[model samples]
Each structure stands twice: as structure tokens, then as C-alpha cells.
Target: METIVPNWPAPARVRALSTTRDGGLSQGAFAGLNLGAHVGDEAALVEANRGLLQQAAGIPGRLNWLNQVHGIAVHPVSNEYDGAPEADAACAHEAGLACIVMTADCLPVLLCDRAGTLVAAAHAGWRGLQNGVLEASIKAMGCKPAEILAWLGPAIGPSAFEVGGEVRDAFLAEQAEAVAAFIPSANEGKWLADIYQLARLRLARAGVSAVYGGEHCTFSDRERFYSYRRDGQTGRMASLIWLAE
Candidate 1:
């Protein structure tokens, strides 16, 4: 199975990967490498895809899945949680444990400290990002924000992510700096939102200076990734990070 290694200056022991929509057995809308079982894909097929991902990553432990309510909830993951946790982000300091977040077009932000002791993955849709999801994830890591490194995973690019006035106002209401992330669209009362820029602004506000990896465009890249905006019923890809054993 192929995976995208985050292009950041993180430590050697801080292993991280983001999966695309390739190398899986799911058919139709949930084509190659659909790792999310909550997306209506067959249970067996989803399991098979996840198994393939685990083998590729060489992670000995189960991936910590979250319910992803698109809120600011962050949870600490360990082996004790046998099933999915109801949170938007997860952090792990354990060697074998992996913190993972699934997404299609929404932003998946992966975080790790310079020392490689803590790692986290956050599902940052517009709601979550505006509601302090990244901040919460960083806080959950229990490390100073300055020592943390972040990588922005695949999501809907600015050109394709047109939003209504209300969506733009929601972010502006929380942080005035968010206004820079939106560009006026041709449609009246609409704007083209740059999710990567918004994430960078949020991370910067939280004091994380070392951020990278925001070139991926899920909506346009049909061959490499699945996009919920491009296709209504689509599969989900995952962004994962963990400390190496």
C-alpha cells in the first residue's frame, strides 16, 4: 500500500503518514483505500482496507478511531479504549499507539512535538477549525505550542471551496485574522475559503511556528484522493501519526 509521508522537519522517530484513495478493495464510491467504517462502506471491506493500512504503516496496535463530532473535543488515546472514541482529535505519547483522523475534503492536521514524545491528529472541518479544534489538540498533547510541529493534510483547495456569507462570518466572528483566508468569489455574498491558510493562522495564534505540508487538493485530485465535495457519496482517507517503537 502507498502512503504520503508528511514533508516536514520532524524528528526521525516521529513517524507520520497520510493515506490516499488507492490500494484497497472497496468498490464504487468507496473505491480504493476507504478506511472509514462510518461512511456506509461494507463492514468487511472497511476492515480489509484498515488492515492493509496497518500492515503498510507497520503499526502493531489498533488505530485510535474517533467519532469526529466536528467540535473542539480532544482525547488522549491508549490501548485501553477498545472501540472508537467520541472526539474530534486524539493524542498519544505511547510508542505503539497511533492517533488517527479520517477525512475526505475536510482538513486533517497532524501534530507532533520536536522531541517525538507526543503526536496528535485532528479532524478540522470549518466548524471544528473555527471552534478551536487545533488549539484543543495542541493543549491535549501537554507540550508547549512552540515545541510542536504540524503538517496540514489533503483537503478542498481554495479554488474549489466556495462558501456562503454565513460560513465566512462564522470564522470572522471567532478570529478577526480569519478574514485574510477568504477571497471574494464571483457569486454575490460568497467567498472562496482557503482552509490551509485558516489552519496556519489558527496554528500561529496557538504559538506553533513550525507548520508545513499544505499543497494537496482533494477536490481536484480525483486519482489520488477521495473528495466529499466533488462526489456526494465518497470514501474517506486517513492522516495518522505516532512515535516509533
Candidate 2:
């Protein structure tokens, strides 16, 4: 039931935390609070672990889990929202409506307004970042971008996240400054990309500069995170945000 609370200056009524691979009933590769039901973990185990998370975290309402497809579909979730929608980002303005995204190595960006009236969570893999997931999420908030506070949750670090040239090219096309985020890796024709910086660049472009929590590396921190790149059949940690009652 271990969780990493976001280190940002969000309002007191905003509740959010990024889960770690610790203190759960999951065994083997999916060990320790594996909340993702779509990652080949045992359905019963995943369900039970999710229940443990709800009880331990005291989430006020049902978590709106999205069937993430690495796309930029931004879903607006309410307390009554049901079913796992095919979306990569979710936003909520209602109190107790938790907006959550599960990730192993992909970046989970949790966002809330400074006033705590709106909250959102986005799953940003390379494709999602390159496309416009963060931008879409912020736009869906229906607030001024400057009023949003964002936290970049644990994901694969640049040292561990190598990518093909196409990935680098895609980002550069979106923002020239993205060049600073990529460097030549040892592998020929490959580049190491800092997803955190790329995400920051995207946020900046969308007028969101108040960002935090870009330190943790899931790939390198095997003891606390489940990395799909480090472990193919792995569990998923969740980053969730909700407006407290």
C-alpha cells in the first residue's frame, strides 16, 4: 500500500498519489500493488490489490481507469462514469471523482488546478507525448493553463530509455528545443531521450510551467517499480488525482 504523494503546491482539497510496487498481494513479476488489470496479471489478484489500494488510500469514489492506448484521447470522467474508456488521459472536476492512469515505464502526469477545482491524470508514453496528450488533458480542464499544477510521476529515465531515430524526429518536429532532451546513446542509430524534459517542453508550449516530480526512474529502480522495458510481463503502478470532499 506504499504510495508517493506528489510534491507540488496544489490546493489542500486536491488529493493525489503515485503508487509504487510495494505492499500488495501480487506475487512474482506483478508483485506489490499491481493495480493494472490489463497487464496479464491475475484478474482476481489485480482486483483484490485494487480493493486494498482503495481501502488504504481512502479514495472517496470509484477510480476512473482508462484503457490506455497511447493516444491523445482526453476523457472527462465524473463520479458516475463507468467502464474503462479507450483513452490515454482523464480529467475530473467533481469532488471524489478520481482520475487515474496506470503505468509501468510510461510517464504518468497528474494535474490539478491551484484552486483544487479540477484534477487530471495522463498516461504519456513516447507516442502520447509526441502526439499531444498533455496538451489535450490541460485543454480539457476548461481552465487557464497557468492555473494548473502538474507532477511528472515515475517513468523510464533517459539513461534507460533508448529510442529509434524516428522517435527523436517526431519530437523535434513538435518542438525544436526537444533536441536538448536527446543524446546519442552507445547503440548505433539510437538515441537516449529524457521523457521528463520532453514532457516539460510540451507543458511549456501549452502554457503550463508549474511542474514538479520528475525524478523517479522505474527502469532503474527495480525494487520499487514495475518496468515493462526492464521486465516484459510486468505490473503497472497508478498515478491518481481527485478533488477531496
Candidate 3:
């Protein structure tokens, strides 16, 4: 199974990767490593693909998956947190506990402290970003923002993420500097947004300065990624992080 290992300055024990639409058991639009079970893929095929991911990635423990709602709700992963919780972000301080989130066009932010005592993954669509998912995830880490490192995973790039005026206005209402991240698109009253930069702005506000991995463009990379905007009925890829034992 093909996966994009996040290239960040995390500690050696922090393991994280974003899976691509490659190497799995599903067929058609959900073909090649479609790890999300709720995206309308057959239950059996999704389960089998998840197994393939576990075997290929060699995850140390069961992945703590989330039923993402594109909100800012942050779920803390531990022995007590069993089954998929309805949240957009997850964090874990325990070794071998994998915090996972599935996405296609939404940005996945993976985080860890400098000492590798904590790890987190967040699903940030435009709404989640505006609602402070990254901030909540950072808060859930139970570490000072300055001590945490973050990676902005694959998402719809600025060039491809066109949005209506309300989207731009909503962000600008929160922070005027957000205006810089939006450029007028071909469609009047619409703008192309740089979600990666917007996320960086939010993280910086919360005192997180060390960030990386915002170069991927899911909307443009059809062969490697599954874009919800590009393909209405597409698959979902998993972005996960965990602390090694």
C-alpha cells in the first residue's frame, strides 16, 4: 500500500503517515486503500482494506478511528476510549495507541511534542478550520503550544480550493490577516483559499511555531488522492499518528 510519510521534525518515536488511493482490496471509485468505512464503500471491502493497511503499515495497536463530523470536537484516545467516536480530531499520549482520521479533500493535521510524549491527528475542512479544530487538538495534547510540532497533511490546495464570499468573510471576521490567504478566483465573489496557510495562521495564534508538510494537493492529484470535490463519490484515505513503544 502506498503511503505518504510526513516529513517533519518529530521525535523518532512519533510515527505518522497519510495513505493515498493506492494498494487496497476495494474496486471502482473506492479502489486502492479506501480505509473509511462510512463513505458508502461495502463493509466487507472496507474491513479488508483496513486489514491490508494494518498489515502493510505494521501499526503497533488498534487504530483509534473517528467518525469525523467536520467539527472542532477533539477526542482523547486511551484504553477507555473504545470504538469510533464522533469527532474531527484525536490525540494520544500513550505508546502504541494510534490516533487516526480519514479524509479526502479536508486537511489532516498531525502533531507531536518535541519529546514524543504525545501525538495527534485532526480532520480540518474549511468549517473545521474556522471552528478551531487545530486549536482544540493542540489543547488536547496537554502540552504548551510552543513545545508541540505539527504537520499539515494532504488537502485541497489553494489553487484548487475555490470558495464563496461567505467563506472568505467568515475567516476575515475572525482574523483580518486571513484575507491574505484568499485570492479572487475567476468566479466573481468567489476566492481561491490557501487552507494550509490558514491553518498555519491559526496554529501560530495558539503559539505553535514549528510546522511542516503542506505541499500536497488532493484536488489536483487525481491518481494518487481521492478528492470529494473532484469526484462526488470518492474514497477516503487515512492519516494516522502514534507513539512507539
Candidate 4:
């Protein structure tokens, strides 16, 4: 199982990895390490792929997965939680418990304090991004935003993420600087939005300056990623972060 580890300068005890669409029991549209349970793949196959992930990646303990709704809700995670909460972001201060988010095209932002005592993961689609999911995650960390380091995981990149004028207008309503992130697409009344740049702008406003890992283009990379825009019915990859026990 090939996993993309964040290349930032995190502390020794802090670990983060983004899974790809590779190395699993799933076949066809959901082939290769599909860890998401809600994407219509067979339950047993998803479970088996998760097992492969745990074994191959050596995750410290159980992952605290979220039932993401593409909203700005952020939850604190622990082993005692009953089930995945209805949230788009999760954080963990306790060791041995990972905070995870599943995504095919939506952006996953993984955060950790310099001390390695806190870790968080956020699922940010354009709506969540505009509505403050990353900000909510920074607030949940209980640390100064400047002290947090973020790694922007794989998502649909700028060139392929076409949107209507309303989508661009929504971001502009929040921050005028957002205009730079949108470029006129060939189609009239449409624009290609740069999800990575938009994320950076939001993080910058929230005071998270040390950001990394936003080079991936899920829509373009069919072999390594699962892009919902590229494949209507597809699997989901997981981006996870945790403090070592």
C-alpha cells in the first residue's frame, strides 16, 4: 500500500499520511485502498482495505473517522466516542487515536502544533472552505494559529475545478482577494477555481502561515487518486493525522 506522507517539519511524535487509490482488495471503480464506507463499495471490501491500511501504514491505533457533511462542524476525537460524529473536521490531543477525514476530490487539511501534542484533520470542499472549516479546525486545536502547521492534502486542482459565477461570487463576498484564485474558463459564466490557493488564503487569514502539500491534482491523476468529478461512482481515500502514543 503506497501512502503519501506529509513532508513538513512536524515534531517527532506527530505523524500524518494521505492514502492513495492503491493497494487494497477493492476492484472496478472502487479499486485500490478505498477506505470510505459511504461510497457504495461493498462493506467487506472497504473493511478489508482498511485492514490493509492499518497493517501497511502501521497506524498507531483506531482512526476516529467523521461522518462528513461538507459543513464547518469540527469535532474533538477520542476512543470513547460512540460513533463517527456528523462533522467535517476532527482533532485529537490524545495519543494513539487518529483524526481522519475521507475525500475523493474535496480538500483535506491536516494540522498539528509544533509541540506535537495536538493534531487535526479537516474536510474542506468549496462550501466548507468559504464557510470556515479550516478556521474551525484551528479554533479546535486550542493553540495559537501561528503555532500550528498545516499540510494541504490531495484535491481537485485549479485547472479542472470549473465552477459557475455564483461560486466565485460567494468566495468574493468573503474576501476580495479570492478573485485571484479564479480564472475565466472557456465556457461562458464559468471559472476554474484554484482550491489550493483558496485554502491558503483562508489559512492565511486565520494566521496559519506554515502550510505544505498542495501539489496533488486528484481529477487529473486517475491512477493515484479517486476523483469523484472524474469518476461519478468512485472510492474515497483517507487523510489522517495523530500524535504517537
lDDT values, one for every candidate:
0.93, 0.92, 0.91, 0.92
Cα lDDT tens digits, model 3, 128-241, are 999899999998899999999999899999999999999999999998999889999999889999999999999999999999999999999999999999999989999999
Q: Which residues of candidate 2, in runs, are more than 4 Å off? A: none
lDDT of each residue in 125-183, candidate 1, tens digit only = 99999889999999899989999999999999999999999999998988899999999
- Quote the lDDT for 206 in model 2: 96
**TM-score between candidate 4 and the true structure:** 0.98
Better of 1 and 3 by lDDT: 1
lDDT for 189 (candidate 3):
86
Error of 1 at 60 (Å): 0.8
Per-residue lDDT over 1-245 for candidate 4, one digit per residue giving the tens place of the 0 to 100 score: 88899999999999889999988989999988899899889999998988888777677677677899999998989778787799999999998788889999999999999999999999999999999999999999999999999999999999999999999999999999999999999999999999999999999999999999899999999999999999999999999988877
How many Å off is the CA of 13 in candidate 1?
0.9
* Reference-based TM-score, model 2: 0.98
TM-score of 1: 0.98
- Judge candidate 2 against the unseen true structure and give its global Cα lDDT, from 0 to 1: 0.92
Worst 10 residues of 3 by lDDT: 55-64
Q: For model 3, what is the C-alpha lDDT against the true structure?
A: 0.91
Q: What's each prediction's TM-score?
A: 0.98, 0.98, 0.98, 0.98
- Ranked by lDDT from best down, the candidates are 1, 4, 2, 3
Quote the positional error of residue 20 for candidate 3 in Å.
0.3
